[model samples]
Target: MGIFIRILGAFVLLSATYNPTRWNFTRWAEANWGTQMPLTLLFGLLLGVGYLIYIGATLRSIGAFGIVLVAAIVGALVWVLIDYQILTLQNPSVNLWLGIIAL
Candidate 1:
């Protein structure tokens, strides 16, 4: 229950500043001289790694009964810190709110 709230809040907060251009990271390939194919593959690989990190973090939070709320809290904080550079009042407002709720 609490984990759901934290995730929802994080998504709502992070999506506000999210830029799709970040996803189009393969533009670097065009400048590299015929490396477009490999660049696209690399982009895909990076996205996969991000997803794997997310999954691993979530899985680690699970305990004998269910998801540990504090684990989710820590994971969310680490995620926002690493992924979006969001740690202060400038970003992740909803995450801050979620943290309050979790507490």
Candidate 2:
């Protein structure tokens, strides 16, 4: 449950920032910039806080090297899938989602 919660949180943070669905903070802020600057800034700051907390804990837990190691492993697995024709980089949206999930 704990692990699941952490994963969920990371997903939320990433999704909130930018996702394949094309609805996220950047778009929201851009659309409302002229009319809702305050609200947009508020949400942007909140999202920044979320990123700080997540990134701080992540670095403290694993450090940069660990992060790279994990990424390399995942990249390798992704490469294998591509080799096996399970994943294709031809679709940019899929690649973007994979990159987001990988992060």
Candidate 3:
């Protein structure tokens, strides 16, 4: 449940900020700032920091490397299930690899 909350928080942050097909907080930032790069970097930093904090707080039992490994496994599994079964994407291998690395 803790891990799920962390992941869900990250996902909500991401979708709120920069979902490709959505009007989001990032768009508002870009519109006001007249630039996208700095906002992008800021949000990315926030996301990374938030994830680290969550992991440290809730995943200490697993340690750093174990947390990363578990995240990679979960990311890969989700990618496979969604891309293959739900989306039926034509080429999901790249997404699977990227998801593992990202998580």
Give RMSD (Å) of candidate 3 vs. truth.
6.0
For model 2, state the Cα shift of residue 43 in Å.
Answer: 0.8
lDDT of 3: 0.65
lDDT of 3 at 14: 52
Sort every candidate by TM-score, greatest first: 2, 3, 1
Q: Best by TM-score, which number?
A: 2
Per-residue lDDT tens digits of candidate 2, residues 8-90? 89988888898767599988888899999999999999999999999899899999999899989998998898999878878
Candidate 2: 10-residue stretch with minimal lDDT: 94-103
Backbone clashes per model, in order? 0, 0, 0
lDDT of 1 by residue, 1-103 (tens): 9878767654543333232334234334445536567766675576667656655666776543345666676777768776875555566646555554443
Q: Best to worst by lDDT, what's the order? A: 2, 3, 1
For model 3, how does the per-residue alpha-carbon lDDT over 1-103 read when each residue is reduced to its tens digit? 9778767776766566555443666566666565666866786678778767866765667777887787788867777778767634566655544443354
What TM-score quantifies how close candidate 2 is to the native fold? 0.83
True-vs-predicted CA distance for residue 32, candidate 1, Å = 14
